[model samples]
Target chain A: MDKKGNPQIDLSQSVDFLVFWGLKTDVKAFCNQNRREKTVQLCNLSRTEKTMIRVNNLIKNYKKVEALAGVDIHVKPGEIFAYLGPNGAGKTTTIRILTGLTQASSGSCCINGFNIEKEVRQAKQQYGLVPQAINLDQELTVQENLIIHGWLYRMKSSEISSRIDALLDYVELLEKKKSQVKTLSGGMKRRLMVARALLHGPKVLFLDEPTVGLDPAIRRKIWALIKKIQTGGTTIFLTTHYIEEAEFLADRVAFLDQGRVVALDSPERLMESLGAWAIDRLVEDGMETVYFKTRNDAERFNTLKSEQYTLRRVNLEDAFLDLTGKKVK
Target chain B: MIHGIIAIYFREMLILRRRLTRQIPSWSISPFLYLTAFSYAVGHGVEIEGHTYMEFLIPGLIAMSSMTQAFAIASEINIARFYWHIFEEFQASPISKVSYVGGEVLAGMTRAMLSILVIMALGFLFGVRLNYGLAFFIALLLNSFVFASLAVALAMVVKSHADQSMLNSFIITPMAFLGGTFFPIDRLPSWAGAFLNLLPLTHASKAIRAACLNQPVSIFSYVLLFAIGVLFFSVAVRCVEKAKD
Candidate 1:
């Protein structure tokens, strides 16, 4: 016991305690107190013991073309992992395979240790999917759609009713519950989809371009909602073509290009590996981006005085362009 | 599996309830028109096999209407697939193939039962009453089961609404007119009668007419309808499994 009547937890046991309780704020506070070793220990524990999604050497082949070739990814619990790519770059294909909508040609995947192909029902119970298409039944009211989802998940009637109320409120769609899906605006429909996906309290949530067609204002609201969901301890696997969305939302980002992952890291680290600042020059054919170590270095580049160029912070798009020599659409 | 089937059936019932105001009227229109036209035009004093022509035609309409209404579920399935994309949601869900087929088949059967009731009411208004017994319902149930299972199977295989219409023309329309619905197969040539006897609907119409007329219902016809229903149900389940792939 400590002098102030609080229990003095041993260093070795505190890691397990914090992890078991999943008190992110307390862990962050402890990590801030110069506990580098403990922080590393906690991270390694999470990486090894708490992988929410694990994919190893996944490949998908169509009749003539390979959509995914030897892809691997490991997503940590309660973190937002983004799969960024251009059009037809296998982002949706990977999501489809992981969600069990498509089968991989070779490799294996597991959700929370349940092999998707072998233990399909158990694996499916571990995650919820918010697909890109607005596939809600337009003839049914928003509340009815959610009720059907709850029943499919096999929840009790009472629990389904309670969760419907809570989730509709969580997504800020409580007022629109009685309205038909076709009557909803695009943003409202997207929000309702999120609510329906979360109806069963899944351990993992798959968001396939959740904010794809929404305006910037609504997109920002969705971003906030995603962050809130993460805080509630749901692991998020997001796939999108929007570079800035990944930069803003993902804790770790994987850049997929032509059925291969070109780069994988935190968005900041991926950008920082090249440089901190970028200078874009209007070349003969298109924009050519040049990176520099510092803003002053970017400003004082000799070509800046002679050519029409602009300086800005390095972004994920710049990093992707650097790695693959192509832009993410 | 049971819960999944109930969930799917519940969704279909909700849609049916909401559209009932329009659907009930539509269900009544055909039987009403058919009864009025047949009874007035050719049935003033006609008798076939010791019964009025309306008595003969009522059971035929019952059989034919039940077959057509039950098979109409295919259009609903196609609309949910192509327009609403609700089938994708079912695919991603943890529900088994049998549960989905069961729920859809049940919905189809419900539509058939409702149409049969409408036809019976129309028959009553025409002053033609037959034995509404357990055998009559059993035959109608088997008939609905056959067509509903067939509907689910065909819905899975068709690529577009146009293809579904073509299937209706090729499979259902011909069966409705030629499967002993309007006239007894004995009235045709022996070769034509043998060909029509091969249809499941022929047995369905025969058994249904025999039961309503209080004649000894043929147990062979009952067994044949049940076997055809099971075969079509197996095919429907297989098609749904293939769809997932």
Candidate 2:
């Protein structure tokens, strides 16, 4: 209560009200007048919590087939968000829309607060993409490819040369800088794609199946590279069908089925919500799965089962199958 | 936008440099065969427009070579689009559609000029020389611009390599032979001359021939070529936008 018979509401207590009322102009002055510490904390919180990528009801249609039936996502800065789906589940379509390679039928999207439709150039400048296919210029050497990409982004020659060297060293392809892209192996080509994407220092990296066809050993190497990239405070939006890859790399996982997100949560939380263990029974018709809350319960059920059954710990794939009634791959 | 276009242009130049040896021989062989066989054998006793047969054939060969070289961009664009997916890289970047069309069109024009220079060198070997003036170069440039713009527009619409080859065989090959390259279109039947006049290459060949002979070149031909180039350039930008979308 103040002298004027009005309630003295603290700005810290109603941060949302301040934001909703468009009080950003007077925030600094109001904070300096009263509750300076609280206001500073709130301002810092808002700054740190800024969303890097935002999508609202994004939808795409190809004639009759609804490729993406309205997807909504918000990714924070410095977060690795994995988009998991089967083939033709709109994973690539959503990525294409985000990267501005294709236009959406409706809805809106933004990267680093720039609208993709209205502020297209600025939005594109905020992110880099590594497509599913090997889209490298086969006639050019690895160094030439990076140089051209840098030039496309309007980078200075001195900056491009230094950045190319750093990126090649980071991807462990420094020795192959002069080799033509066609001569590189599949894994090397994939690494080169990653290096090329990072050369411009984009705020967000969109990787469409970065390790799609690589063997397990090379896949692990790429996973390590992805983690290293995230450590540099760049947001990563990764699309892959490998459940284990999502579970191992993502801060949060989104499971899309038939152009809609069926489940989205942290991998541990999603797996834990289903059960701690699962039993796979080889039935007459097909393989049936049963989930149990504890290992002892799973073992008990396994012994009582007459048919062949194996008990194992619940993983992201189990959670996906349980949610969508289909496998990730 | 300019930087992105320069990047594309530089890449094409690098590829051209690497394939220059193979390209030079192929581009020179056709003109050599045309000059040695047509001018020396069939036209040894024939003269046209107060010039020797070899002198008349030189400017026509220049026009044909320029048209073919400029239109050759369609094959490169098709390869980039279908096999390498290089256009996707540009589409995903911040480059404008105009920049992409401009860069590719310029590359095509460069190829045309180089091929013209090669044909001119071969003309020297045959002891056939003509007026190499500002008007001759301007006509060649305008001619290249028209075909290169058309090539960019066609490249956007073509689906496969076979489609590109079909266009080369059916459209380009006919224009090269019948558009006054080997003979004068005025000597043909009235209906055939009218039909050939509709093709831009006919005007290109006439303007190039008149300029090379130091005769009065028609202002209408240059205007027509410029208009056609502008029309096709606009169409190419639109097609690029559609393809990206």
- Please give, for residues B1-245, the per-residue lDDT of candidate 1 as tens digits: 99899988899899998898999889999888877887778676888788888888888989998999999999999998878878878877888889999999999999999989988988888789899899999999999999999999999989888899999999999999999887889999999999999999999999999999989999999999999999999889978865654
TM-score, per-candidate, Cα-based = 0.90, 0.90
Fnat for every candidate? 0.63, 0.72
- What are the candidates' individual DockQ scores? 0.25, 0.29
Q: Candidate 1: lDDT of B174?
A: 99
- Winning model by DockQ: 2
Query: Which candidate has the highest TM-score of all?
Result: 2
What lDDT tens digits, residue by residue, belong to model 1 across residues A151-206?
Answer: 88889999999999999999999998899888999988888988888999998999
Q: How do the residues B187-222 of candidate 2 rate in per-residue lDDT, one tens digit apiece?
A: 999999999999999999999999999899999999
Candidate 2 clashing pairs?
none
Give all candidates' CA lDDT scores: 0.87, 0.88
